[model samples]
Target chain A: MMLELISRNILHRPIRTFITVVAVAVEVIMVLVVVGLTHGLVTDSAKRVEGIGADVMVQPPSASVFMAFSGAPMPIKLAGKLQELKHVRYVAPVLLQFSSSGRLDIVYGIDPQSFALVSGGFVFHEGHDLQNPDDILVDDWYAKARNLHAGNSMSILEHDFHVAGVVEHGKGARLFVQLKTLQELSGAQDKASVFFIKCDHPDDATAVTDEIQQMLPRYVVRSLKDYMSLMTSSNLPGLQIFINVMISLAVCIGFMVIFLSMYTTILERTREIGVLKSLGASKAYIVRVVLGETTLLCTVGAAVGAVASFVITHVLVHAFPTLVILIQPEWVFRAILIAIVGGLMGAAYPAWLASRRDPIESLAYE
Target chain B: MEPILETDNLWKIYHIGKVDSPALRGVSLQIMPGEFVAIMGPSGCGKSTLLHVLGGLAQATRGSVLLDGNDLSNMQDAERTQIRRCKVGFVFQRFNLLPTLDVRGNIRLAQHIYGNEFDPHRFEMTTNVLGLSHRLHHRPSELSGGEQQRVAIARAIINEPKILLADEPTGNLDTANSDAVLALLRQLHRDLGQTIMMITHNPEAAAYAGRVIHMRDGLIVDGIPA
Candidate 1:
C-alpha cells in the first residue's frame, strides 16, 4: 500500500516527475561517456606499449611518454652504449613525430634491421621491410583510410615515398619509415627522440632497466611493466582531475534535482502525510515512503542513461572507426550506484521534514 | 463501568504570535464503552479540539486524555501513535480517504499499518454494515459524498479500535446522504457494541446519539440522556 501510494503520488505530478527523471538520466550519460572515453584511451595506450615488445624504454628525464612528434631529441649514440650492456639483444633508436593534417597523426621512424630483434618487431600484412630511402609502412586501417597500397606513391612531410608495406592494425604505429631518413628530413641528425631496448632474456628486464639508469643518469629508463601501471586513472596527472571534476558535477546534478523534487512533493502532499500519521504510521514508515519514490525514479533514470550511453558509443565507434571505447560493466554499475546514492541523499531532508509534521495541524492545513 | 475514552479538565491553546487563545479550556468528559455519544457546540465552542484531544491526535495544553487507561498527554509521540493504532479510530468532516486507494484499499491501509492480514469474516461484516460491499473497487473520487464517508468509517473500524472519534462526518453530504450515514453509524454501534464519539454543531445530528453533550465557550452547558 505504501508503494502504491508513492507511485500514485509521482504519477499525479507527471510533468515534474518526468523532468526530474530526465535530469538524473542526463547525469548518468555524462558519467558514462566522459569517463569511458578517457579510460579506453589509457587501456589502448597500454596495449600499444606492450605491442612494441621492448623490455625497456629510455626517454627525457621529465617526460612521462616519448611522443615521437613532440619530445626533446636525445643523443642517438645512447643506443650504442645500451647495446654494450649485459643481456642487451637489440637497441632501436626511434623518432616520433605528430602531424595535424586531418586530425592528430603519429609518425614513427624505426631501424628496420634492429626492430626485427627479439626486443622489437613489426609483422607486415604485405610487402617487405623498408627497401628504399623513401620507403614507408602503414597499418591496414591507415592504408585503407588514405587509399594507399604497395607500389603506390604517398606524400608525407612534403616528400613522396613508396608504400613499402601495410602492417596489421594496433601494432603501435600507423606510419613508419627508416630512422636515418626521418632524422635527416627533420634536421634531427645524430639525435633520436627515444630508445627501445630489447633484452636477450625477457625475465632480466628489470636488471637491464636498472643498468640503463646507472649508465645514463640524465635519462629516465623504465621497465615496460612500470610504464603500463602508470596508464591508470590516477597515475596520469590531468586525467585524474578531469574525472574527479566530472564525477562531482554529476553527483551535484543528481542530488539537487532529486532533493528539490522530493521536497516539493512532500509539501504538496502534506495533508496526505498527516492522514497517514493519524492512521498510526511511524516516522520511519513515512521516511520509507519518500525514499521508495526517489529510488524508483533513480532506477528508471539509470536504465535510460545506460541505453543512451550504448547508442552514443555505438554511433561514435561507427563514425570514427579509430576511436576506442571500453564501456566496462563496472563503469555502468558505478554510474547506477552514483545516481541512486545521490538521489537518496537528496531525499533525506524532505523525508525528515515529512516525518516531523504534526498530524493534527496538517489535517487542518488547506 | 470505566469510560473507554476520558478527558480531565483539558485545555488546548493556539498561539498566534504572543497571544494564547484557548480552544479547549478546563473541559472534562467521559463516555463509557458501547455508548454512542455526540458533542454539540457552535463553531468556536472547541468541540473539534475536544474531539481531537480525546482521540490522541492532539495533546492538551494542561491536562490529560486517557483512552483505556493510557494517558495521551503524558505519552511521547510514538507511544501516543501506538495507542491510536491499537485503541482508537478517527473520522473527519472532509472524508479523508486517500484518493489513490479504492474503498477496499482504503480499508486495508489501516490493517496494513497494524501489520494485520485481512480477516475475511470481519471484512465482510464491516462491508455489509457500511453498505460498501458493492462499491469496494471504486476510488474515492468515483464515490458519492455519503459513500466516501462510509469508506472512511470502514477504514477507521478495520483495525477493530476500542473507540471511534468522528468530527462532522455528515457535514459534506446532502440531507438524504446525511440521514443515511447517521443511521448507518448508529446501526454499526448497536450491532458491533462499539463506542462512538461524534462532534457536530447540528442539533438534528445530535438527536441520533444515545447521549449528547452540549458545549458553549469550551464548557459543557447541558448533557441530554437518550
Candidate 2:
C-alpha cells in the first residue's frame, strides 16, 4: 500500500519523473560502458600475454607495465643472449605498438615461430597465422569489426599490409603482423618492445627469469605469473587516475540529480506532506515514502540503462569493426548497484527535510 | 466523564517581521468524551489557531493542551505524532484528499500508518454511512464537493480515534453540500458515540454541534445567546 502511494506520487509528475529517470539512465550507462571497456582492455591484454607461451617477460626498465603503452624499446639483440642462458628454450622479441585509437587497436609484432612455440592456444578461426613479412593476423572480433578478411589489403599506421588468416578470438593480439615489418614500420629496426623467454621446462621459469634479470641488470624481467598480475593494474601511471575521475564524475552526476530532483519534489508536495502528517505519518514513514519513490525510480532507470548500454555497445562494435569491447555482465551489475546507492543517498537529505516539516505550516501552505 | 480534548488558557503568537501578532490569547476550553462541540469565529479570530493547538499540530506559546490526559506541550514531537496517529483524526475544510489517490486509497492511508490490522466492519460501516462505497474507485477530482467531504469524514473515522478535529469541514461546499456534510458529521457522532470538535463561521453548521463556543479577538466568549 505504501508502495502504491509512492508510485502514484512519482507518476503524478510525468515530465519531471521522465527527466530524472533519463538522467539516472545516462549515469548508469556511463558507469557500465567505461568500466566495461576498461575490463575488455585488461582481459584482452592478459590473454595476449598468456598466448605467447613464454615463461617470463623482459622489458626496458622505463617501459610501462601495460603492454599497450610500453613504447621504450629493448635491444633486439638481447633475445639471442637471453636464449643462450641455461634452461632457455626460445626467445621471442615482440614490439607492442599502440595505434592512435589507443589500447583497442594495439599492434603486436610477433616472431612467428617463437610465438607459435610459446603459445599453447593458437587455433586460427578463419585464416592461417602470419606467413609473410607484410601479412597480419587479426582476431576474429576485430576481423568482424573492420571487415578485414584474408587476401584483403589494409593500411596500419600509414604502412600497407596484407590480411593474413583470422585467428580464433583471444588467441593473441587483435592485430598481429611480422615482427620485422612492424619494427621497420616504426623505424626502429634493431629495437623490440619486449622479449618473451620460453624455459626448457615449466619449472625452470623462475630460475631462468632470475638469471636473465641478473644478466641484463638494466632491463626488468619477471616470471609469467608476476607479469600477468602487473598487467591487471589498479594504478597504471595516469590510466588509474583517468578511470577514477570518470567514476567519481558518474557518481556525482547520479547523486546530485537525484538530490536536487527529490528536493524539488518534496517542496512541490508541501501540502500533501502536511496532510500526511495530519494523517499521523511518522518522520520515519515520510522518509521511507520518499526513499521508496527514489528506489523505484532508480531500479527502472538502471534496467533501461543496462539495455541502452548493450545497444550502444552493439552499435559501437558494428561501427568500428576492429574494436574489442567485452561487455562483462558483472560490470553491468556493479553499475546498477552503484546507481541505486547513489540515488538513494541523493534522496536522503530531501527526505529528511520533508520529514521535518511542521504539519501546521504545511497544512496552511498555499 | 473525562475531557477527551482540553486546553488550559493556551496562547499562540506569530512573529511577523518585528511585530508579535497573537493568534490565541490564553484560551481555555474542553470537550467531554462523546460530546460534539463547535468553535465559531470570524477570520483571524484564533478559532483555527485554537483548533491547531488542540490537535497537536501547533505549539502554544503559553499554557498547555491535554488530549485524553496526555500533556501535549511537554511531549516530544514523535510522542505527539503517535497521539495524533492513535487518538486523533482530522477532517480539513479543503477535503485535503491526496490527488494521486482514489477514494479508497485516501481513506486507507491513515490506517496504513496506524499499522493496525484494518477493521473491515468499521471500514464498511463508515464508508456506507458516508455513501462513499460506490465512489471508492473514483479520484477526488471525480467526486462532488459533498462526496469528497464525506470521503474525508470516512477517512477521519476509519481508525475510530478517540477525538476527531475538523476545521471548516463544510467551508468550501455549497449550501446543500454543507448540510449534507453536517448531517454526516452528526450521524457519525451519534452512531459511533465519538467526540468531535469543529471550527466554523456558519451558525447553521454550528447548530449541528451539541455545544457552541464563540471566539472574538483571540479569546473565547462563552454563553453568547445563540
The per-candidate TM-score of the B chain, in the order shown, comes to 0.96, 0.96
What is the per-residue lDDT of model 2 for residues A172-239, given as tens digits with 9 covering 90 to 100? Answer: 46788888888888887888888888898979999998898788787778888887777653746766
Specify the poorest-scoring 10-residue window by lDDT in model 2 chain A.
A96-105
Question: Considering only N, C-alpha and C atoms within 3 Å, which residue pairs clash in candidate 2?
Answer: A53-A118, A125-A168, A127-A165, A127-A166, A145-A321, A145-A322, A146-A321
Q: Candidate 2, overall lDDT?
A: 0.85
Candidate with the greatest TM-score versus the true structure: 2
Instruction: Give the CAPRI rating of model 2.
Output: high
Candidate 2: fraction of native contacts reproduced = 0.80
lDDT to native, each model: 0.85, 0.85
- DockQ leader: 2
Candidate DockQ values, in order, are 0.69, 0.84
lDDT of 2 at A209: 82
For model 2, chain A alone compared with the true chain A gives a TM-score of 0.87
